[model samples]
Target: MNPLYSPTAERADNRCEYCHAPELVFNDLFKVEHIVPVSHGGSDNTDNLALACRSCNKYKADFQTGTDPDTQTTTRLFHPRQDEWSQHFRYEEEIGEVQGRTPVGRATSDRLQMNRAAQIAARRLWMQLDLFP
Candidate 1:
């Protein structure tokens, strides 16, 4: 890892801050991503960094906000350093889905495919093994 990139995996408990997927489950190590992109003037400060899965990092890119498909409105995505995860998303064990509790959550979910098939399957397995909440 680059010196500029802190080990956010430890801070995030080996989880992707965006999707909460365990970094250990991925084929390779997760990325240390900027909460805001450098192209967008985001800095290299650790406070602005997050551990991210390739899927979430690639999907999020430089976007800080996203469109809510259900409402057709633009809303801010969840901020790992600033926003409370539980305030926006709740893990539904019954369906193994990350349910959006607010517009921000909903938009973030849609933009990042948080409830995509693969993630849902992973969540189900994680839940069964007592690895997920």
Candidate 2:
């Protein structure tokens, strides 16, 4: 593991910064990811890192902008370091889905595939175990 990984996971409460799911619920350890791509001149500093699941990390890749499904507007993705999660997203525990409340949120949510079936199934189990949102 990268030495920086432990602290990044700790800082993110062992949850995915984007999906907000606990690492314990996943089969593999969560990924320590660059919130901004190193290819984009992003740094490896702790401030530029976020804990993410394999799914989110793979889906997000290096892109930070997408069209908002709700508005069809091109917008910047939600910056876990800069944007407040609650301000942009709302967790619907009943449906086990993260609802994006804003354009940026919706774009991020859609691009990240936050509501994919595999994720929802895992979240359902986590909720039952009292380890989820």
Candidate 3:
């Protein structure tokens, strides 16, 4: 493991930062994610680290910006270090889509592909377990 890498178990209170699923109980591997990726000149520091599930981490790899598939407009992704998740996204239970209230939110959702089918499925399961809102 990279010395700069804090264990996911420790970083996120054992939960996925994005979906809030308890990784200890989910049986899926978790990863230490850089809020700003190293490739983008992000530093390896506590403030820049977050815990993410393998799926979310992989989907978000190396992306600092995203194109809204709907509008075809390019926008910067949300910066976890500087932005609050709730400010950028809201979960819609009926549609299982993460609605973006701002450009940053929309871009982050698009870049991370946060509304992907698999994520929706997982979120549905988590909701069933009363683990998701």
TM-score of each: 0.92, 0.95, 0.81
Q: How close to the true structure is residue 8 of candidate 2, measured as C-alpha lDDT?
A: 95
How displaced is residue 89 in candidate 2, in Å? 0.7
User: Which whole-number lDDT from 0 to 100 does residue 45 have in model 1?
Assistant: 90
Clashing pairs in 1: none
The global C-alpha lDDT for each of the candidates, from Candidate 1 onward, is 0.86, 0.90, 0.75
Ranking by TM-score: 2, 1, 3
- Point out where model 2 deviates above 4 Å: none
TM-score of decoy 2: 0.95
lDDT of 1 by residue, 1-133 (tens): 7564446777888788977887766688888999988989999899889988888998999898998877989998888999999999998889988878889998998898898898899989887777787
> 2 or 3: which has the higher TM-score?
2
Q: Cα deviation in Å at residue 2, candidate 1?
A: 3.0
Winning candidate number (TM-score): 2
| Per-residue C-alpha lDDT of model 3 across residues 1-133, encoded as one tens digit per residue | 6464455457567776765556755665678788788998987777888888777688789887887666878888776557777887798999777778888777777777788888888788878888776
All candidates in order of lDDT, best leading: 2, 1, 3
Any runs in candidate 1 off by more than 4 Å, and if so which?
4-6
- Candidate number that wins on TM-score, 1 or 3: 1
